[model samples]
Target: MSWSDSFLVLVLALAVEAAFGYPGRLYTRIGHPVTWIGRLIKALDRSFNRETWSAGRRRAAGLLALLVLLAVTGLAARSMEFALAATGPIGFCAIAVLASSLLAQRSLHEHVAAVSTGLREHGIEGGRAAVSMIVGRNPQSLDEAGVSRAAIESLAENFSDGIVAPAFWLGIGGPTGAVLYKAANTADSMIGHRTPRHEAFGWAAARFDDLVNLPASRLTALLIVIAAALNRNASPRAALRALFRDARHHRSPNAGWPEAAMAGALGLRLAGPRIYGNVRVEDRWMGDGRADATAQDIDRALVLYRTACTLLFGLALTIPMLIWLIAS
Candidate 1:
């Protein structure tokens, strides 16, 4: 497909996802496919128990899995394209719907909203439980402020990973690109850790995921800052400063951008010492003004997220129209 065609597909897919979201409860009841994918990876991980496999074999397996996922997604998209050519616009709409199902805009919003609701009703414990699913950190010991910070941070970070990054890839490479990026991200989530078992084996997944997210994460931060300014809660100056100052401090190069921007926009601090699988890492704080974060701050962060998403949808549609005009 041409670049313009891919851009059109992305806009349509984003519209579909933004409108309908992933059928989470239904997908969950039917068995979450992503969870099943993780389980499959876990099962395969057992084969490396020998502790003596050549590095070459591990690398080969990771590459092979990535290639298979990419190929399968490509075939699916090509099949849809063929059907569209033979059938009609309905086939194209079906392809768009199928592509959008793979993105998780609605799912991300629902998870974050659940965290906010839990905080409102059940306090810290409830909030922690809701946030824990999205974050890798141990939530059992988090206080109210910590829980609130986690929720806001997850909202900022996932805006890039779950929404913007996938959309960016889809714009560039169509459904095939979206699927490949999702597969890499899913693999990284499943195995990307500092644990002895996966430290070496997951290097490729982690690095590739970072590469995929690099640009989208920065753009997500910019969009969030713009959204905050539009909401009258934050200035562009603070947003830009926070984005540049703290974005590199986070372990993941891409995640820090949006998280830092959210922190600055909300005038709250995020990221610090946290336990992960019994290991403790002293993370640097992201914002400058305040250490105390509240449930209200979480709500503000959500507003920023919604605003950014809306702005993104507008931009996606406008960019295509502009390109078409220039070409004409």
Candidate 2:
């Protein structure tokens, strides 16, 4: 497809996702594209990530599996794009709908908002239950502040993973690029860890996922900072400062960018040491701000998230025209 077609598809996708998120009925009926991607990864993982194999062998097999994953995911997405394009301009709308289904801006907002509501309605326990849906950390171990911080951190990090990254790839590479990213991300989540079982086998998936997310993660931090600057009460300078100071200390090369930006924007400390299941991870804090994060702070983060998403969407629209202008 042409660059104009790709950009238009992305803009439509962003608009559709911002307006009407993928419906629960649709999910219940067919599950999500990620779920479909997850199934494929699992199948490949089961076949290739064999425990009986030597670590080196497993690693090599894992790399092979990733190649297979990329090929299949790209082909599937291309077929869908082609089928949609067959419908002409109406096909572009169909492509937009398909692409939008892969993004999670509205859904992420709703999920994080639920954490706030749960905290307000039923205290820490309610918040814990709500947050457990989105975060991998054990909810039973969390206090009110922990729950709130987890919700906000997840919000900031996922804004890049779930929305900006996909949109960035789509704007540049179309629906196929978006889906391929989703596939990579899914593999990382499922297998990308330092755990012995997955350490060798998941290395390629983890690294590939991180590589793709690199630009979007930093871009997301910038978007958040710009959004905070636009807001009267938020501190864009703090966000920028926090990015330089704290983002480097984060274990994940990308996650810290948005997390620090968020922490600074909201004037709350996030990341730091946290327990996932029974394991206590000794991570550096993202911001030099108050640690007493609350549901109210979560609500504030959601507002910032919305603003950042809008700004990123606007950026997506501008990029193609700018490229065209320069080319012309």
Candidate 3:
């Protein structure tokens, strides 16, 4: 299919996911796409990631495993796309529904907002419980401000990673690209770590995920800045400033952009030092704002997130029209 058609698919998928996220019942009946991908990664790791092998051999095995994963995922997605290609509107809608599963728009909002609700209703204990669900850090280490900041950080990072990246790939490479990206991302999450076992073995998955996520990260940051511009309470100028000043300093190459923008737009400091499980990671701060974030701040961040999502949908719609106009 043409790029225009792919973008149209993206637009419809965004709308469907935003309106009704993958239903819980549907997930119960048949596992979600990511879960399916995760199972495959688990199988590959069990079969190939042998500890006795030299690091070089293991790394080679890792690359080979990643290639196999991508090949299988791409072939399956392309086959489905081909099967649906001749069905006209019905096929388009069906593809869009399948594609919608890849996005996290509605679920991200719900999860982040749950933190605020938990904080407001049940105090620190409630806040920790809710925030723990979304963040990898030790929830017990956080105070009220820390909990709030963690939630906001997760919202910003996930906005780019979970929502924008998938949609961006969908627009560019159709179903094959989107699913293939998801497979790589899942592999990274499962094995792309600095741990002795994963460090060498997961190099390819980690590096490739970082590369594919580059454009979407910047685009997500820009969308957040624009959303800030539209919100009276948000500071678009601060968001833009943070993008230039602090994004690169962040530990992650891509996560910094949206995190910094969200921090500046919301006037909060985020992603400095944190304890993940037992390890203390001393990362650079993202925004030059208040560190004592509150539940109200989380509410504000959700506003920006919602606005950014809307802007993303708008962007998806606009691209197809532009492509059509240029072609004409």
Candidate 4:
């Protein structure tokens, strides 16, 4: 396909995902790209992560394992890129479908909506269960407010990681960029824990994920700040302040940006100390807003999130056309 045609496909893929998401029938049968990448990451983790190895050796093994992962996934994605170019219109459509599956726009909305609905209908127990599926914290330990806060935090963070990051890469380099990102992200999720088993072996995946996600995560925050400018009880200035102050204090270099931005945008506190399983993490909170968050706050956050996504879509559509015009 031509450059303009390729960009059009990239934009279409984003639109398709934002509108329809991945099809359930396809998910039930062949599964999704993230799932496929997850399986490979799991296999590599199983094979390379041996407790018998020394920490230094395990770290090196981790680096080696990551390279192998990149090589395998990169080849598959590049082959797809070539095949798409060779097959004309059908392949273009096929690649757009494949790229759409790599994004999480539709599923994110559904998942966050489920959490809010569970809270409204099933009370604390339901909210906790729904929130637990998305967050790392111990669900049973959370109160109604905590559950709501957790759900909102997950929405903001994953909005950046799962949605914006993939789309940014896809827009830049199409399917190969999108697939490579998914592989790195999957590896990070699978092995990026600080536990004894993964602390050394998962180092590369964690760091690489951080590096690749750096730009998108910040852009996600900026988008949220812009969205906050258009809403009430939400301050764009506060969002910017929180993003600069609290974003640096969070555990993950990337996650804190959007999470802090969303927190400030919604006027709610997030990411404070929480219990994950038996462990209590003394993490700093994001935002200088309300401490007692509610389901209503979640609704507000979702509004801001949806608006940010729309603005992002507009920018994605416009920037390329501008470039095309300039070049011509």
Which 10 consecutive residues of model 2 have the lowest summed lDDT?
1-10
Using TM-score as the measure, the top candidate is 3
Better of 1 and 4 by lDDT: 4
Q: Give the per-residue lDDT digits (tens) of candidate 3, residues 216-245.
A: 999999999999999999999999998899
Q: Estimate each model's TM-score.
A: 0.91, 0.98, 0.99, 0.97
Candidate 1 per-residue lDDT, tens place, 1-328, comes to 5667777777888888888887758676875535655565665566542357666676666555555555664576567666774666676677677678767777888888888889899988889889898888889868888888888888898899988988888788776777677777887887776666676667677888888889899899989989988988765677778888988988778888998898888888888777776878898888886877877888888888889999888887887888899999
In model 4, where do residues sit more than 4 Å from their true spots? 1-6
- Span of 10 residues, lowest total lDDT, candidate 1: 42-51
Q: Cα lDDT for residue 11, model 2? A: 90
Candidate 2 lDDT, 187-238, residue by residue in tens: 9999988888899999999999989999999999999999999988689999
**TM-score of candidate 1 versus the correct structure, residues matched by position:** 0.91
Q: Distance from true position, residue 139, model 1, in Å?
A: 1.1
Can you write out model 4's per-residue Cα lDDT over 1-328, one digit (the tens) per residue?
3456556667888899988888899889998888888888889889988999999999999999999998999999989888886898898888887788888888888888888899899998889888988998899889988998998999999999998898888877677888898999999999888999999999999999999999999899999999999888689999998999999999989999999999888888999999999899999999998878888888888888889888888877887798799888
Candidate 4 has its poorest 10 consecutive residues by lDDT at 1-10
Q: Pick the candidate with the highest lDDT.
A: 3
